[model samples]
Target: MTQPSQSNNNRMVIKLVAIVIGMFGFGFALVPLYDVFCDITGINGKTNPYAATYDVNTDVDTSREITVEFITRNQSGMVWDFEARTKRITVHPGELNTVEFYVKNPTAKDIVGQAIPSVSPGTAALYLNKTECFCFEQQPLQAGEEALMPMQFYVDPQLPEDIKVFTLSYTLYDVTGTSSVAMNRG
Candidate 1:
């Protein structure tokens, strides 16, 4: 009887350990899984990181106007002043448009910053084609330096008829430390 009891306890312990390990594995997988899900459903406004090719022959749908609103933010610990020069613009579908953003380094030292962009009404991200954007590269600025960043994009004419407005937001982060480390390594 004692032998059987000990055997049962050992099995229970092993089962619990397996469950914990499985839970940890699931936790590690959640991020990539969520990204995949978002990519498929267009849930979190994940925009493509590559430049979009524009066809000059594409017809501009002048009748369909979309209101695009620009917003900006600095990540916590980032001290740079950043803003979109244009707050909002009305654009015709399939017609190219441009907007400029302003950034200044107020700190006394040079810093490298990177911008991450997202489009709200998330589904519209798929149709928002960017041909040129500052967000594509890390921006390095000297102290007291100011620069104008431009973004050129167009909305696909095939966008759903019910969607007439979308918001494009950029969050800038201070990546000076990592960038410096990489540069040193090189």
Candidate 2:
């Protein structure tokens, strides 16, 4: 037979094991739970927010036709189409890459609005060489048409040095659409 002190010790051990199991369960359930929270709040930058802090620039590199794409907001009633010379490009820091941005209307009818470009995860503007494009300004494109856009950029030779590659992504959004503060084209 076990002494009372031994029985008490055994009970404590069992309780500790149960607590550990509960902690693991909580840990396993947290990832998906956090995702849902981010989805709703856009704290993850997956959707647009009520007030976004970014820059807007509209300029074309008359010589280079760099590619740009329009990624619409979630189930919101909007769409995007992009036209550029290239989608995948590589260049050394401080080297200029002429990027052309073209905004093509997706709707059959003319839609007048602005295009907000954002760098996903959490970063400020599109940086190239000596230029910082913080999402540029509001653009007004005609319906069922295309507009030429440009971003003259060069990699920052001092981009952490250890960083060899980075994809300059453009995520197009409409002011009058769902928020995709987290979902970026990164």
Candidate 3:
């Protein structure tokens, strides 16, 4: 009777350990799963890392106008002054436009940062394309240094007529500890 009771207890312990391990694995898997969900549905307006380039010969749609608003933010621990030079712009679809963002590092030490971009009116994210953007690469700024970053982009002519305005926002994150290589590359 004693041996049977010990065997049952051992089996219960093994089961609990397996359950804990499974839960731990599931937690790590959620990150990629969330990304996949956002990509497919465009729910979070996450932009693709790569810029898309269409043929130069493509025609612009001059009749429709799109109001693009730019917004900027600095993540916690990032001590930098950042803002869009132009708050908003009216542009025709398929017409390439450029805008500048100002960034200054006030801290005494050098810092490395990366800008992550997103579009609002999440459905419109698929139609907003970037040809050239500073967000594509990390930025490193020395103390007391300021820089003007440029972004070149266009809206697809096929964007639905119901959506007249869209916003593009960028959040700057300090990547010093996570990406030491980025600091060197910038």
Candidate 4:
């Protein structure tokens, strides 16, 4: 009787340990899951990834002008100089515009960086489309090397009339150590 009871207790302990491990795994899984939810709903100002299949033939709406402001930031411990060349620009809806950002690797060793973008007044995210954006890929800069990153985008003509000003911001994160995992994770 004593042997059977001990075996049952051991089995229970193993089951509890497995449950705890499973719960911990679920917690880590939530990070990506939350990102997907925010991206789809635009609840957190997360900009949608550029879509290659999007139609670009829409007519430019010249009657109204929307001011787009550019903002750049470097994540903590990032040793690169990054800034937008153009502070802001006014454009007609549906017209393609190009802007440039300058980035220099000031450190002695090569580094890789990834840019994550967000649009203020989250509602504007749905109408802002990018045709060509450096944020779409990881940027690798050699020591003391500098490069100009260009982004081509357009404000959809259907943008809500109430939003006359929209801000597009990018936060560059250093991913030198975890480049492979961070590249696709963002």
Candidate 5:
């Protein structure tokens, strides 16, 4: 009887160990799986960070108008004032539009900042094409300096008719320390 009980305990322990290892492996695989899923379904609002080319001959969908809303924020501990100059705009798909963002370094020291953008209703991300965007590069501003950054973009005419409104939000992060350290080392 004693031997049988010991064997049962060992088997249970082995099964539990295997379960944990399997769970750990699955955790490691989640990121890649999520990326693939997003790529297929376009549900995570991930936009191409690189510039996109626009054809001049593309037909403009003048019959339909879409509303785009812009929002901006500073990351925690970042001491810069950042905002979109225009809060909202109505535009026809396939027509080029430009928007300006204002940024100011109120601190006494120079700082480098980067802006990350995301679009709501994730499905609209693939349809939003940016030809030029300040978010593509890091911005360096001197103390008490202010600057206007521009973004040129258009909505693909193929965007789904259901997605008539979308929000574009940007969060600015202060990369001063990392940038300065890299510059000094190089």
Candidate 6:
């Protein structure tokens, strides 16, 4: 009878200690854990989760019709819209051209958003190229008003001398965007 009572008392102490340690671990993991959750859900930050891959022949002077795409994930109660200045463009290898990315606030009130673009290798990007990008600048859109953001870029015949294929990917995220990373040379 004495042995059984001591065993039960020890088990209760062990359980209490386990709960306390578990809570401390949980508290310590809060910040990192929240970051992971935001990354997966696109809540705290926006990322280019997907990009369309395309290959251009830098050897020839031709026109390329590349569709830039925008995607939002796990958003709640906000409507966002995006458009491009031109759907098709013509350029020669080593010649840089400017393109546009248009974002709109479709809601009844002013909406702010950000755009992040990732251009493929052997290509460059510029802000002037976008007629309406809310990326480098915070885009504050009035209800039903559209803005054009621009990016200037081109494919270089000088791409690594060994690379032949390139792709550009853009991902727009966050109700409030905070980053802009660019590739300036082909």
- Assess each prediction's global lDDT (C-alpha) against the native: 0.92, 0.50, 0.90, 0.88, 0.92, 0.51
Candidate 5, residues 22-79: lDDT per residue as tens digits? 9999999999999999989999887789999999999999999999999999999999
Candidate 5: clashing pairs of residues: none
TM-score winner: 1
Model 4: residues with Cα > 4 Å off, grouped in runs: 1-33, 51-56, 180-186
- TM-scores of the candidates are 0.93, 0.45, 0.87, 0.78, 0.88, 0.44
lDDT score of model 6? 0.51
Model 3 ranges with Cα > 4 A deviation: 178-186
After TM-score superposition, the amount by which residue 163's alpha carbon in candidate 3 deviates from its true location, in angstroms, is 2.4
Judged by whole-model lDDT over C-alpha atoms, candidate 5 comes out at 0.92
TM-score of 1: 0.93
* lDDT of model 4 at position 181: 38
Q: Is candidate 3 or candidate 4 better by lDDT?
A: 3
What overall lDDT, based on C-alpha atoms, would model 1 receive against the true structure? 0.92
Candidate no. 2 TM-score:
0.45
Worst lDDT 10-window in candidate 2:
121-130
Query: What is the Å distance of residue 111 in model 2 from its true position?
Result: 2.5
Indicate the residue-level lDDT of 185 in model 1: 17
For candidate 6, the TM-score is 0.44
* Per-residue lDDT of candidate 3, residues 12-62 (tens digit): 999999999999999999999998898888777877788889667768999
